[model samples]
Target chain A: MGGGGEVIDNKQVILKELVKGAPKESDMAVKTSSISLKVEEGSKGLVVKNLYLSVEPYVKLRMKKFEHPDFSSFTPGSAMDGFGVGKVVDSGHPEFQKGDLIWGIVGWEEYSVIKNPGSFFKIHHADVPLSYYRGILGMPGMTAWVGLHKVAAPKEGEYVYISGASGAVGQLTKLGFDDAFNYKEEKDLDAALKRCFPEGIDIYFENVGGKMLDAVLLNMRLNGRIAACGMSAEHNLEEPEGVQNLRIIIHKRIRMQGFVVFDYFPQYSEFLDDVLPKIREGKIVYLEHITEGLENAPAALAGSENVWKQVVSVSRE
Target chain B: MGGGGEVIDNKQVILKELVKGAPKESDMAVKTSSISLKVEEGSKGLVVKNLYLSVEPYVKLRMKKFEHPDFSSFTPGSAMDGFGVGKVVDSGHPEFQKGDLIWGIVGWEEYSVIKNPGSFFKIHHADVPLSYYRGILGMPGMTAWVGLHKVAAPKEGEYVYISGASGAVGQLTKLGFDDAFNYKEEKDLDAALKRCFPEGIDIYFENVGGKMLDAVLLNMRLNGRIAACGMSAEHNLEEPEGVQNLRIIIHKRIRMQGFVVFDYFPQYSEFLDDVLPKIREGKIVYLEHITEGLENAPAALAGSENVWKQVVSVSRE
Candidate 1:
C-alpha cells in the first residue's frame, strides 16, 4: 500500500552464492539492518525508493559473463542491478528533484543510490499506471519501437512475421500486424505464411530467426525486408534448427539485416517521438510476464529464459 | 598477337551442360558462325567487339540453379552472363552509336546484342583502359561503392577489415582502409584492431565471414560497421568454421549488414556519379583478375576458385 513507516537502515538482500544453472531461491538472502538511506548532498546522485523492479531476459545474460553484450558481471556479494520505477527522495542533479519519479538502472532492493542520476528518465506521463514504467513505457517499449519501426520499418498491409509473438516484444510487434490479430499458427510453413498473408509479407520483423525465419522466407513477397533483432528461441538451445531457407534471400531478393538496440540509441529521441504517441494513444500494446518480489528475481529470470518480454515486479507497486 | 584473320565468323562460348558440381570446360562449348559485321538500320541495341569479361565469384553461383542471393542464377543451356566492357559495332539505341563503348550485364559470348540497356555509361575517358569497365568502372565497382560509402559509411583513419583482401571487392575495401593498416596483429583484440587502425576501424566490408570474420572482430573499433556482402568460404563448405567471436558484435556495438547488387541497382547513377570522380582522380584503385579468350572462360573462373578478385577475360582492348 506504500504506507510510510520508520526508515529501515542498512537492511538489504545479499546474494550468498553465485548461481550455476537456473538460479534458485536459496541463492539470495534478505536482511534487516542499519544503513543510511540518504543521498549525499551535492553529489550528482539520487536516492530512490524503487517502487517497481523490472524482470527481463537480459539480466540472465548478466548473471553469467560469457562474452558478447550489455550488462556487467554481477558481483557475487552485491545486489543485482536492473530497471525500476522509483520515487526520488532527494536529488543533487539539476535534472532531478525530490519526489520526482524516474525510471532507469537501479538495484533489486527497496531503495538504491544511483550515481550519474541524470541518466535516469523523469516520468512525464503520470496518468499511466506507474508500474507500466517497468515495461510498456520503458525498456521493452524501446526495444519494440526500435526493432519494429526503426529496424524492420513495417508498412501498412505489409505481411509481418514476428517470433516470440506471445512475449513482450512479440505482442508489441503484433500491434503493427493488424489493428486486431487474426493470429494463428500454420501447420505447414507455406500455408501458414499464406494464411498469415496470402498477399505475402513485405516486412518480416525477425525477433526469432531459426525455423521461424525459414518459414517466413518462403512466404515473403518479392523485395521483402527482414530485421534480425534477436534469436531468443534458440539462445539457450545448443542447436537452433538450421536455417535452410536462407536461399530465399536470393530467390525472393530479400534484405535481411541485424541490429542491436545499443547501436540505435542515438536515435532514441526520434524513436520515442514515434512510439510515445502510439503508446499514449493505445495504438501500441505490450505483453509482460511479471514475477513478484526481489527474492524471486533470479528465479523469475530463470523461469523466463525460454520466453520473450518477461518482466519481474520486485516492489509493492 | 593483335592480328587475326578477317572473314573469321564470330566464335562464341555457351553453357552446354549445366552441372551439379564444379563446372568443367566441357560444360561450356564453343561454336563459330557468320554475322554481318554490320548493324540493322535504325537499331537502338548496340553490338560490339566484346573486349573483356569480368569473372566474379557470384558467376559460379549464377551457373548453378540452386539459389542463395544478391544475384540471379543463369538459365541452363544459355550463355553465362556477367559484367563486361566492349566497343560498339552497331548502334540502334539513342544511348549508343557506332564505336560508342559501354559496360554492364551482357551475354557470355564473343559479341552480344544488348537492348533496353540501363546506364550504358558513354566511355568519355578513353585514356582510362576500357578493361577498367570490368572492374573499377563496372558492376563490382558499384557493389563495393554502395556497400562501402552507403552501407559501411567508412570514416578516415578508422580501421577497416576486408576479408578476401586479394579479390576485386576486397582490394577496394582495403583501399578504403588506406594508410591505416599496420603490419602487426595484436593480442588485445581491441588493441589488435588499433594496431590495424592505430586509428580504429570505422568500417568493415565483409566478403568472407569465417576465420577472417573472427579476426576482423578483434580489430573492430567501437561502433564499427560491417558490410556483409559475401561469405564465399561458408557458401561452399559443408561445415563452415564456427565463429566464436560473434559476441564481439555486442561488445563493440558493431553493425553488420548484407547486400545484393540488384537491390542497389536503382541507385546506379547515384553510385556512378559519387564514385566516378574518385576513379578519374585516381583516388581509388581498380583490380581485375582476367582470363583471356571465350574458350577459356570456364577455366578462368575455375582457376581462381581459391584466389580472390580473379576474372576470366572473354575479350580485350
Candidate 2:
C-alpha cells in the first residue's frame, strides 16, 4: 500500500434498482469513496489505474437480479464490472509489474484493485492502441473471431448472416468472416443466401435473432452450421417475439451452438497468435468509439446506441 | 384422371380465411370434391389413397402467411400438404404400382394424386405400425431425430433443454437427445434449467422460447449452444417479451439458429441409417397424442396450448 500517495476517492456507477424496459437516468447512481488502491501484502492482487473501460450493451444485464442454481444475477447498487485497460500503478503480485499495461476484469471507475484475476491478459502490444484491448484486439474482436472461425466455421462462398451487423462486435466480426472466409456480403439477407449460396447457407454467425434470423432460416443449406452469437435487436423489447422458420433446423440438419468468451480463454494465446500480427500488420480494420470521463460513463453506456465499437475512457488519458 | 371410376364427391378439410394464434375449429371448413383417384397417364404421379396423414404443429404455420418467411404457408381453401402414409391405388409413375405402401408429401384428403412421386419414400418398415411413419419414421420423426442429432449436435453431459418437451416431436426429439446425448429431464421449465443444470446448460434445443428461453439464457454455460428449433411458448403472444439475459450472448458467446428440413433431403437416406436402426430396435421411444378423424384435422393441427405433439390420423388404416 502506498501510504504517502494522495488518495482520490473512487467513484463508481451503480444500478439504482432493477431497470424497466429502456433504462433512464434514474436507474443508476454514481457513488464515490476514498478507498486504498492496494492489495494485501500477501494477496495475489493488482492495483490498476484504469485507462479505458469498454461500453457494451451487455451491461444492461446487471440491472436485473434473478436467482439461478448455477449463476447469480446482478444485485442493485453494485459497482459495474467489465474489461478495463489499465496500468499497474501498484502491484503485489509477481506476474505483473508496476509499470505494465494490462487489461482484464475491473470496475467502471478511476482505479480498481482486483483479486480474482482469472482471465486477465497482459497487454503485450502496447505500441498499438490500448483501446484495441476492448475491441478488435480484445473481447469484441475475439468474440467475432471465435464465433465465426471456431463455432460457425464459415467456408468460402458460404452465406454468412450477422444480425446486429452494425454494432461493434457485429461489424468487426462481419469483416473477420469476410476476411478469413472469402465471403461476398449479401444485403438481402434471404436473397443473399439464394444468390451467394446457391448451395445454401453453410455457416451463420448469428448476432441478431429476430427478422434477420427469420430471413436466414429460409435459405439455410442442409448441414448448415449457425453460431448463436447475440440478439441485440430483441434486447429491449417487452416480450421477445417467437422466431419463425425454426422448422428448418430439423429439415436441414443444421448445427447451432452458443459460446462464452471464457470457454475459449484457454485459447487466448492462440487467438493472439492468429490475430495480433494481422492487427499490427494493418491487415485488419478496427473501430473504437471512446467516451471520456466517469461522469459521462453512465449516460454513454446508457443513452448512446452505437452500432459499432464503443468504449468509455474513465480516467484522464 | 379416371373417367369411368366412381366419381362420388369426397370431402376434404380446408382452411378458410387466415386464423390468428392457435387455430380453432371455426378456422377451417370441410368441402367435397368429385375429382377421380386415378392418375393421368402422362402426369407421372401416383394416385395415393391416404391411409394415414401426419398432422404436426408446423401445420399451424400454414394457417396464415406469416410475415416471417418459412415454407410457402398453406393456401386458403386449398388441400393443405403434409407427410402421410398411403396405399398406391394407381400410378402413372413407373416406380409406383397398385398395392405399394408409400408415404411422403401429400394433400390432406382421402385420395390425393401426389404430383411428385419422387417425394414419397416406399415404406419398407411396414412391420412396425404404419402410423409410426406419420411421426417417428415420418417427417415429425425425422424432425425429431435430425433436429436433435443434426441441429442440436448435443455433446454427452451437455445440459440439453427442450421447450415443447411434452409434444410428439418435442417428446420424440427429447427422447432422441436423451438417448443420443446426456441431458437431465426438466419439465417444471420455469425452474427446470436451474434445478437440473446447476453447472449451467451446455446445449439448448429451443423448441420453446420466450420466458423459458430467457431463463435458459440466464443459466447457459459460457460457450453454450442453442438450436433455435421452435418457440411454441410465445407462438400466440402478439408482442413477445424482451429477454433479459440476451446480452449474456456477447459475454458467453451463445449461438441461436433457425432452420428448415427442405435442405437436408439429400441426407434423408443417411439420417435413416442413424435413426431407423434405433427405431427398429427398442432403443428409441416415441409417443403421439392422436386426435382421431379427418373432421377434427383442423382442431388437431391447431394443437393445444403448450401441449406436446398431438397427431390426427385422417386415414382408417
- Among these predictions, the greatest DockQ belongs to 2
Tens digit per residue, CA lDDT, model 1, A239-265 = 334455454454465566556665565
Q: What overall lDDT goes with each candidate model? A: 0.63, 0.67
lDDT per residue (tens digit) for residues B1-317 in model 2: 46345555666888787777667878888788866767765678877787777666556666765644445667887887677788998788888889899878778887887778887788776677777776677665565556667766777767776656555456465444532311235445546566666788877766655566777878887667676654233444355454445555555756665545544567778877776777678677666667787777777666554443455576675
Q: In model 1, how many backbone clashes occur? A: 23
> Residue B127 in candidate 2 has what lDDT?
71
DockQ of 2: 0.22
Q: Give residue A257's lDDT in candidate 1 (0 to 100).
A: 56
lDDT, candidate 1, at A185: 46
What lDDT is reached at residue A57 by model 2?
A: 61
TM-scores, all candidates, are: 0.79, 0.67
List ranges where model 2 is wrong by over 4 Å.
A2-43, A46-94, A97-100, A106-118, A151-167, A170-258, A285-317, B2-38, B55-81, B156-161, B170-205, B215-225, B230-253, B269-317
Give the worst 10-residue stretch by lDDT in candidate 1 chain A: A231-240
Give the per-residue lDDT of model 2 (tens digit) for A1-317: 34345577888877778866666666777898665766666777877889888776666544554332323445677777776789887777788888888887688777788775555788887778888887676776777778878887777766666656556456564444542211235556676556655665677766666656677778777778877654233443455445655555654667667665556767788888888787777776676778888778888777756343678887655
Q: Highest lDDT among the candidates is held by which one?
A: 2
